[model samples]
Target: MSVDEEQQPSVIEELTDVHFKFEVKEVLLELTRQADQENTLLALSVSQLGAEGKMRTYDLTITSYLRKVGLDYCEIRDSNNQPLHLISSSDKHGSDLLKVEYTKADINGPNFQTTFDNTEQNLKVELSSLDFLLHTKALLSTINYLNTAVPQELTASKDREAKKQVEKAGQGKTVSKGPTNSNVFTFKLSAELGSFRVEVCDDRRNIADITIQGIDGSVLVQAKETMVFARLRDIVVLDVDPKTIHKKAVSMVGEEVFSFQMSLYPNATEGEGYSDTSKVDGKVTMRLGCIQIVYLHKFLMSLLTFLDNFQTAKEALTVATAHAAEKAASSVRDFAQKSFRLSMDVKLKAPLIVVPQSSTSHNAFVVDLGLITVGNSFSLMSAEGFSLPVVLDTMDVKLTQLKLSRTTLKQGSPQTDIEILQPINLEFLVKRNLASSWYNKIPGVEVQGMLKSMNMALGQEDFGVLMKTLRENIGEGSKEHVLDVNKQVARDKAEQHQLEGNEVGCLPVEAGGGGGGGQPAAVTNAGGLGENIVNMLLNLEIKEVVVKLKKSRSDQKESPFLVLHVAQLGIHTNVRQYDMVATTYIKKISMKCLEFSGRWL
Candidate 1:
């Protein structure tokens, strides 16, 4: 028979209650055999109804072996077996049997309470020992069968005989049997619970292939293999704690856990309506044995190990990324420093020189002489002419002297005896002149009458003569005389001195067709021989020289130029190589050139 061809059992259509009674007799001799015996009461009640429609009830009674206490009443003991109270009850029906009222007992050591429910319709009893209660119920059920009313006992025996006859009739008969064929049983295991259908195959060899479905005919357990057959005992145990199965389903399938909920109707037809019925919230537990349980443990362990490895790999990647970022930033900083270093080399290569000129009609000067490079531009100091006094404020030897030379000059008359002073040693002057030749052009202009007048004021010494000459010619009137000469003199005199004292100084004697004579022939009739000599000296190319007159810490003079300044002697280029060099340093570096138009006196 295939599964579909098998007829399913019909559900019970109604409920029936059958009253039950039992007679129990204890052997008196067995009670007397124990020493230290006392009257003992055994408390029990009905606990369950069996599948075969049997009812069980328990009678609690007390018996005494001693004649002193007799059997007048039953003594009740607590759950701990200690006597607590005496109990008795009357039967109004005039029977000798005692009625047992439901009561309670407390066990102090284990802290538990035992109670009994004694309603006449349905009796229930609880005891400290669940095993004792179960045994008592089983005994009562057995006795109830033995002591059933004669008519009911006869009916029960006839039913048993009919079942045996049916089995006998089926024996030796050919019943179609195969894996595909099945016999199904439909029943409610308990009131208010969902219905169940168990399908069994007809072939004995394939008997282990069973399936249990819910009320809606959805399959719950399909036993297609021997392992499921061995799980029969676990399946039966799982029925008690169905929530365990729900939890497992939730863990495995998450939100789909509810899809496996047991239905309330077995074999429910499509579109069929159900009548009003009591419903219960139930669960189903799938009890897997040791093998499946071990498998779940290993699966969880492997999952945890995989997570650990993933975390370690992620941490390593993070560290590598951080290191790469640091290295890149460091490289950028180094490259920037290198680029700045390359740019600095170009900026330091160019040098600058500044020449500031100051002039008046009688004299022109290069004042505030300064030579500057990129390193020392800020140290330039301002002064009045090349010979202006420079105070020695610092002790460093390198800054001992401010180097200076004449830029432009105007010679005074022979009578004026004016002279320009040298401001440094003659040795250093030679070095400067060697470096440049621009100083060779400064002209010497002389008015012989002016020089003779200056000589009359002096006592004829060189220093006195030079001072007297400068005193007369560098005065304010002398400057006016030099500039206003063309404004009053004849055009011939002005033209004769045109190149001599106007914009350019007097022309050189060689250019003027004079032999090595010291004086110019143009001034021969204006002054005496001494006057002519002074005039010639004035016309000599005299470059203004600077003496950086520093006072030496020792007694020795600080510079050779100090003596020339003290003597008021005009520095001549031929007297010292340094004078010539200093003249060149000034001409090349100064904005104004020194022009010489005659020989020295």
Candidate 2:
């Protein structure tokens, strides 16, 4: 005998009793897009198990479009007392590997085959058969094998005693033994796709496990189906408007149906198959709660209703373009100043020759000397002894040659005992050494010519005289003659002053403070010698001037006659001379007094 039977007491007892009944509440299937054309593996599981005993097995057959597509036969029941299990099958391969397993007492045998003959005629069919002739025989064989070597009468008596004890315990007390229970179910279904396993467990009161997986055993969806029982006394029904219900229903199924049609046909646009209500009903019924279903439905419907509202899109595009432009402008401006400086070479750090002069010095140099900026046009100094603002205008500057000129003068004795003068010119060339190699080979002859022209235009005669004197005085060969002439002119002037008895003395005078003084002569003009000479010259006006000539014996020629002219009291005097005397006066008085005297004074 088995351990359980051996341990059984002569007087048996039952623990407790509970009853359960399940009814067809509702069925819902939600499909987002469409079933794959290659067929998909789907699995449904009893997420929860409630009853203590093993659930009775049944056949499941699904039919659509007048075509049968399900397992030949399948039986699925809870294996453990838990309230959840899984059931799965594929739709790719034709249904052939489907099988059913059940309690021997609940079926004709340990396994049963499902036939699709009835499913071919009905689009939907659920068959729950209770024939257990073969199952009962198997259960009896197991019981008998376990309870061996016991008298029939004793077995009957013990069974009755056990029943009595179970009844007595239930009256007021607890019992040690409990009834045998089963609550979990695992099975496999065969479909056009492939075979899939299903597991069910009963852990909670009324929840079932439902899972779908692919042929390669990839999990797709997992769901928990909960069965809620409401007593008639406690049930509350809410009255909803028919219009509201219809609107909610339409909203709930719009996208789902559209997406389904789109998946079925690659060319389908949005809202395809929208008029098909069956697709909408299929998804709407799957919502666990009415409120969620309604909300989703309304949202989908609103999305379609206002899909043409493109004003916001236009505004968004405008704002994006504006932002892009702003960014581009900022980027350009960031380097604008630097780029300008580089291309123009006008920035502060560019190569510069800053000849910074003090205000006073610059003003004096530019204004007093009539100097101008050689290359740059802007003034560095103003006449008011202020630094002039500088502005950059161009970049080309050529350094040219600079030239200097100098002159010197000397005195000579003439026939009237007056002095004659000779002048010398001096020139110095200053050439610029430019850094550029190109300038080294080019002679600056044009530049030198320009300088010479400018000097002549400024003051040719004065410059020539001054330059001639400077050259004679400082030239390499005639330095001694220049010095001696200058000394003789000074001595002659001194002697002339002495002959006139002009002694010079200075005395301070009340005047502005710059060298304010008075001078006195060496001798007063008591004899008026200078005045007498001036009067004698002024009184000499003849009606007809005559010229006389003398011959010099050594020259073997007779000199021509010479006459003199003088201006007296605004009356002009004219004189004529011929021969040597005329030549002598022209060379002596005319040249010396007119040219030399004016320059010297």
Candidate 3:
């Protein structure tokens, strides 16, 4: 619920191959990068549309990840999601546009490219542009969406690439390598709007973001489980054979029972993404469908159970890392079989949120979160030997159906000029931030201390039994439990939360949109992160992502929806710049970005 974020993309303004200039107000830079999430930058600029005429145009730049904005015809637009006028049809990607670039002076090397001194009027360089690139017409169309904006809202740019990536991301996993050549097409979508009663014209296409916020670690747990599944999927490509999968249910935390089944198409036909036999477009693909149980704590333990030397820290660490990883690999290899599509009788939400209609009797306390069944394809065709990089994709799992239930939460802001290092709506990265802090204080025993602390102050003594009773009352319950727990936890969170978990996630950056997508009404602040702790920079590269669009610096008060794809984004500010800087970034996190999103090169 930030005051600055007004993501109203009704129209896009185009600046053709103009000599783009930028000036980063230290205040805007300081406030946004420090106050808002990372990946968001606000700038003041003037670009040229024609080389023949010295026509300098001004722009209020608000962007994240995206480097340059090109208008199709070099025209600008008005607040109404309509174009004021078209600039020139001669506009195109190369000469008519996309000429401005910036080159970062490497810490130890000279920036032979365009170096940004960051003056009010800076020089445009062919050296570097932005991590993302956007155009006018599509952008304007996206911006025009603002006229129809809603209260507490966010939206994704409808760029073709962005649209395709989102469309392709139908709940599946992609093979992630270091940093693929992909662009961020979305931006953070959280907003505080004066209008909304928001209704999607196309429920199938305009699916709402998913929010996960229950007292149970559904958000956190599911995140870890997905990672485990991704890893196993990676291992499967090596074995080159799919097997029949069916595992018995195992109880978790004495409440929910977890089980799994995964089946791949073209059964033992090896080299799907490798040999010509499976080639679809000079590439092979192994279509897979998987269903795994999602018992928050137990499924976690099962993964740990795989390790050779396994020990669970009853305090901070909930699952065994070494042991679970091993077992998970085995499970995935076994589950990666040929042809078996998962069929469900439940109604499907575009990106469905399902909860197991049935559970073990012992699961008296069902958390209602099942393993997120994302049936996407993974690329196994590579020259490297098992270079494990997992991508998030959307697909149909041909095996078992997973269950999950929840709503979405929103957050975001616009920009200022600063070198970007992308960070967006990652609710789970809170664990990384907390982990970073723990590593800072006590590298060895930090995890244990953190777990104990986060749970300690939130619930009342009887809340446990109350939850137990409530679970029994509606064990296989409605979505109310998740919502109630999230709200109650947010309300009960100690006004000042102790920093002990992992410090993960980036700035609340560039243009996409994330109005308060289903964020509970009662919640006012990012859970766990209090006011004092509000900003961060990891000085690290993100290896995986899921966004697919780029946007321009528009007058929209809000930042563009931050895309989950791209290697780096946002203004690069050192984390240690100030403790508060790191804290501010951490404070804007929400729970929706973890399970279902991203892009590929």
The reply for model 3, stretches above 4 Å from the true place, is 1-21, 26-279, 282-601
Q: Best TM-score goes to which candidate? A: 3
Which stretches in model 2 have alpha-carbon errors above 4 Å? Answer: 1-85, 88-202, 207-601
The CA lDDT of each predicted structure is 0.23, 0.23, 0.25
Cα-based lDDT at residue 443, candidate 2:
20
Residue 417 of model 3 has an lDDT of 18
Between candidates 2 and 3, the lDDT winner: 3
Candidate 1 residue lDDT tens string, 1-601: 7664453221121122343344433222211112267533333222111221222222222211110111211243335775321212222232322222221212221212122221112212211100111121223323233233134446447645754655554343443222221221111111111212222111011111111212121222211111111112111111111211111100111111111223222222112211111211122223221211111221222234323323433544454454334333333321111000000001111111111121122222222212211110001122343221111111111111122222223335432322223222111110111101112121221111111101111112334423533453244334534433434245436556534533212122122222343134223422343311111111112234222222333555332222111122232333222232212221321121112233221
Per-residue C-alpha lDDT of model 2 across residues 1-601, encoded as one tens digit per residue: 8888876642232221333333222233321212255321222222121212232332222221211122111122234543111222233333322222222222222223233221111121222111111121122223333233244466447545754654454344332222122121122222222222222211111111112222211111101111111111111111122222212111111112110100111111114332221221111111111111111222222233223222333444454454334333333321211001000111111111111111111110001111111221111111132122111122222222222222221125321211111111212222222211112122211111111111111123333443543343224224433444466467558756543632111111111111212121112212234211110011111122212222234466433223222221122222211111111111122111222334421
TM-scores for the candidates: 0.13, 0.10, 0.16
Candidate 1 RMSD to the correct structure? 60.8
Model 1 segments beyond 4 Å from truth? 1-156, 163-287, 291-601
